[model samples]
Target: MRLRSCLAALALVLLGGAAHAAEECPAKSTSMDDIIAVLNAAPGCDRAMKLFEACEYGASGDVQFGEIVEKKCEADFLGHLKPPQKLSYQRELRVCDRKYRNKSGTIYISFTAFCRAEVAQRYSRRALKAGGAGR
Candidate 1:
């Protein structure tokens, strides 16, 4: 019974350490330009640009600018994900969209900056989750 108790305690400790090792977003903020640089270097720049174009179209008052920007930003993020990662990130993408949905500024620049930050933060977290190696 004592041996079993010790093993159980050890298991919990190991699991707790693993969970702690999973990366969350940094508290230290980054500049919009830095985020943009990261997004430009990421794999989904073309898709992001298309999404940005769609946001621009809607921003011309074809649809609600905020709503379209939010949706397109989420789509751009999801576009970068692999099939397996999509389901995992669905809820997160929605949360990210809602957080930025009502933002107001220059349409192209704002949406680009917003999407860039979102994508950079996602990639940063992913890298940390993979033990500092990016996917």
Candidate 2:
């Protein structure tokens, strides 16, 4: 009888703690301007660094490309972009390469850095409408 009562009290305490923890968690609020600012203000290398950092933060470690993305590839994309690169939006058709880890077909990875002006233009327009990015 005493053990059952103690267990019930512990369950209630844990449930209450979980509810409090959830309520204390901060909300996620990111704007297009924040993204653009990080991308625009920085030079090629700097921009890539920030992008890699952001991708790392967003990616689950379990993802095959996540670590490589955070450490190596982000700068490569910046290298390919034109000077004074800014985010804009429009739609453009593109293809992506699906890469794999090793000779073994079991672990697969995909890394694609295919963003066209059209997509950027479209995104820019939508971001502007959404009051995210300003002209």
Candidate 3:
């Protein structure tokens, strides 16, 4: 309960920078793997696995998780940036919620982010130390 809440907060905080990083990387198919890789590198393998699992899915089948939120945010951002020729100095992000299911379980998450630019480089050092970049 409390721990999960705290972890969620931590994830949100960590996500701030990651969202920006994704903007810089502009996750085009191949970049999705890179984004996940960066997240995997942020922490050691074991911790990364735990975080990844938690973010990907929560304890309950009814609740949305961090991973879904992030993915939706990223997608929203890309949709807005479509055609790529409309890019400008300003940037923005939009997030949405979604749900999915498998034979094993039901999943809920928010997956979206939008922006005209990226700030991944700005927090590169801190992210490395905080284990956000997976390094």
**Poorest lDDT segment (10 consecutive residues) of candidate 3:** 111-120
Per-residue alpha-carbon lDDT of model 2 for 2-118, expressed as tens digits? 999999999999999876654221213344334444434444432333353453223222132233322232333433444444321111212212223233432222222222222
lDDT of 1 by residue, 45-89 (tens): 334343333333323232232333344344434455688777666
Q: Which stretches of candidate 1 lie over 4 Å from their true place?
A: 1-84, 107-112, 128-135
Candidate 1 deviation (Cα RMSD) = 13.6
The runs of at least 3 residues in candidate 2 whose Cα sits more than 4 Å from the true structure, single-residue gaps closed, are 1-29, 55-96, 100-135
lDDT of 3 by residue, 26-127 (tens): 223333454465444433333333334433323342122234333422332333343542242123222122112322433222122111012212223333
Q: By TM-score, highest first, what's the ranking? A: 1, 2, 3
Q: Please state the error at residue 4 of candidate 3 in Å.
A: 41
Indicate the worst ten consecutive residues by lDDT in candidate 2: 87-96
What is the C-alpha local distance difference test score of each model? 0.47, 0.36, 0.35
Q: Which residues of candidate 3, in runs, are more than 4 Å off? A: 1-63, 83-135
TM-score pick, better of 1 and 3: 1
lDDT-superior candidate, 1 or 2: 1
lDDT of 2: 0.36
Displacement of residue 55 (Cα, Å) in model 2 is 6.4
